[model samples]
Target: MLVVAGAMAETSLVAFRGWPSEALEFYEGLTADNSKTYWTAHLTVYETQVREPMTELLAALEPEFGPGKIFRPYRDVRFSKDKSPYKTHLGAWLEAGGYIQLSADGLAAGSGMYQMASDQLDRYRRAVADDRAGRELTTVIEAIEQARIHVQGHGSLKTVPRGYPKDHPRLDLLRHKGLVTWQEWAPAAWLGTAAARNRIVDFLRTSRPLRRWLDENVGPSTVQR
Candidate 1:
């Protein structure tokens, strides 16, 4: 989202017709040359072709999924060893839930918490230890994976945490610091059509039970970040 001086005004919202082929190609070029020159030279294409369509998609999805915000494409290189200037993909998160990204590889969508905090992890472990909540979560994850989406944990402990039995039936859940469901589609003809939005909507809807389970059981962090 680099805006040059005197660039044309922001593009108004339109019904999401899906991204054009050029949008993916823009990221391809950025991946090769992640410098100011590449970004400045192609800002027009990024704005009109890539950013505008993303905005439209977010607008179209507002009613059912709530609002969405696109993440800025610039990379925060101040603390990283690699100083690449820009992100290679466009990503956005819905206000209610779910994430979407478009890049040279493909379109991808995800739902559920990516990571849990200390207090949240405590709650997660307690709920996961309970037979009722644990079994409910197991059913939700199974249904999601059965629909062909991938569900997995992140930052998992090698063994059970303190006070949890190592032989616990839901050891996978107990070890997790986070849980999420993901789906990806390689670059395809449907990507440049409304089918892209439909796919994302379906994935989000299908994985919603997982989000609901976590919200009801684990909730959010009490300790501030």
Candidate 2:
């Protein structure tokens, strides 16, 4: 179970890094660990249900994303001031992948899993507004938004009052920091389950279609493809 969970987490990281094969190996090593703290600490109800299934899913996805080993522990703080010897958290990036940070105050504070980047965010907003599923860009955007909302709402907000002030620090941070915003299109119920992850993967697999649609509508001159 631990191995499966680790693999699921590593697969997400590896995909972000553009190295699918290495991501598999990364998960393998994590499973070998006797101490399961890493996996245990991160797994939520959704993660717990889908971890094993996602191992096979990631294996199938390996060919598309490429193969490479997990990144070694190293700090590259050339752009930051906090020169800690090691990264405080694990992270990944693929092109303009949005940033996600786990809050120190735990998930219930509603500050975890923020996605940022103004241009990309704008594109996402437009896609949701337009409901373009066949397009590669729209599919990815939808998957991300669905996954993010599920994780954020289910993993956090468990104790938050329904009527918590909109201007509260957490809500304000989500808005000002562009972490998350309310959407009229999204369903009211939470979609935090293994099934939700599978649905997300299915949506992401439409990358080719999305690319074609983006080419036709948005034009190649816009952001990097």
Tens-digit lDDT track for model 1 on 18-107? Answer: 889999999999999999999999999999999998989998789999999999998998999999989999999998889999999989
Q: What is the TM-score of each candidate against the true structure?
A: 0.93, 0.27
Top of the candidates by lDDT: 1
Model 2 has a clash total of 5
Candidate 1: residue 222 lDDT (0-100): 82
lDDT of 2 by residue, 1-225 (tens): 999999998866533211223233333444454233544543452133223333333444455533212223336768978554343323322121122111111111111224324454444334323434324433444664554432222222334234445444344222322322122112212232233333333433423333334334433223464
Model 2 TM-score (2 dp): 0.27
Candidate 1 TM-score, true structure as reference: 0.93
